[model samples]
Target: MTFEASLAETLRTFQALSSLRPAIDRAGDLVLATLARGGKLLICGNGGSAAEAQHFSTELVGRYQKNRRALPAIALNSDGSLLSCIGNDYGYDDVFARQIAGLARPGDLVVVLTSSGNSANILAALAEAKKLGLDTIAFLGRGGGKAKGLATCELIMPSESGAACQEAHLFLIHHLCERIDAAYAT
Candidate 1:
């Protein structure tokens, strides 16, 4: 495919998901509500998804835009000690769950990203988040996987390609963050 064609395809796929603006808007509202109520946001994923989770958390805890007050956000996969200890003792599936149990409070939001939506560790974390009464969201692809079923709100792109799905997911988070800032703007 030529450069233009490839870019067109990418943009088309993004638009497909973007068309669900109503749902995305609702999810963004819930995120803002959680934060407004003094609840934190926790995110998790694996590999590239892990990086995305950290990126999202950083945007919130620092500022997606300049000069904004820091928001409370945690990327559960960032802490090496907690990840290693949880994996070593309780098993990999429980790594995120253990951290969620320790840090999450009622009304907090947990966002899980997985292209296949079946990542064991992430699903386990969702389970824990539910138990803790936290609002949950999942960025999923490929039939929305198990994470879709478990999350309170899910945004699933139609793309089956992992790279495309992840790229779209990152942009989705960016939009979410942007909406969050708008809703909470002073």
Candidate 2:
């Protein structure tokens, strides 16, 4: 495809995700509620999605805007030592779940991201989150795979391509960061 075609395709996918603004707003509200209730936010994913999980958590736990107080957001995928030990002891699929069980409190927010939306680790984590009374959300593409059915809130990308879906995910997280920052502003 030409550059113009690629650009148009990218724009098309973004336009599709734009339709999910209300749902994203709802997710922000959920996260804000969790924070207000003194519950931490936990996030996880695989590969690029894993990176996005960390990126989003960093925004929350650090500063998204200038001179903001830190919040509590943990990315389960960030600690290689914990992941390795758990995966070695149990199985790879249970790595995230085990962490969630240990760290997540009731009314916490757990955000799971998966490009295919069917990652076993992510699914297991979501199940654990639900069991622990977390407010769950998913960033997924291609019909949201199994995660859609499992999540309390889902942001499904309009496109089927991985790149497009991932782009949508990034934008969604950015919006969340901005909203969270504004919500906490005194």
Global lDDT of each candidate: 0.86, 0.88
lDDT of 2 by residue, 1-186 (tens): 788877887799998776898988888888988888898889999999999999999888878875577889999999999999999999999999999999987778899999899999999999998888777999999888888889889888887778788888998899888888788855
Misplaced by over 4 Å in model 1 are 1-9
TM-score of each: 0.92, 0.95
Candidate 1 yields a Cα-based lDDT of 0.86
What number of backbone clashes does candidate 1 have, counting pairs of residues 3 or more apart or in separate chains? 0
| lDDT tens per residue, model 1, 120-171 | 9998999998888888988888778877778888888777767778899899
lDDT of 1 at 77: 92
Off by over 4 Å in 2: none
- Candidate 2 has which clashing residue pairs, if any? none
State the weakest 10-residue window (summed lDDT) of model 2: 61-70
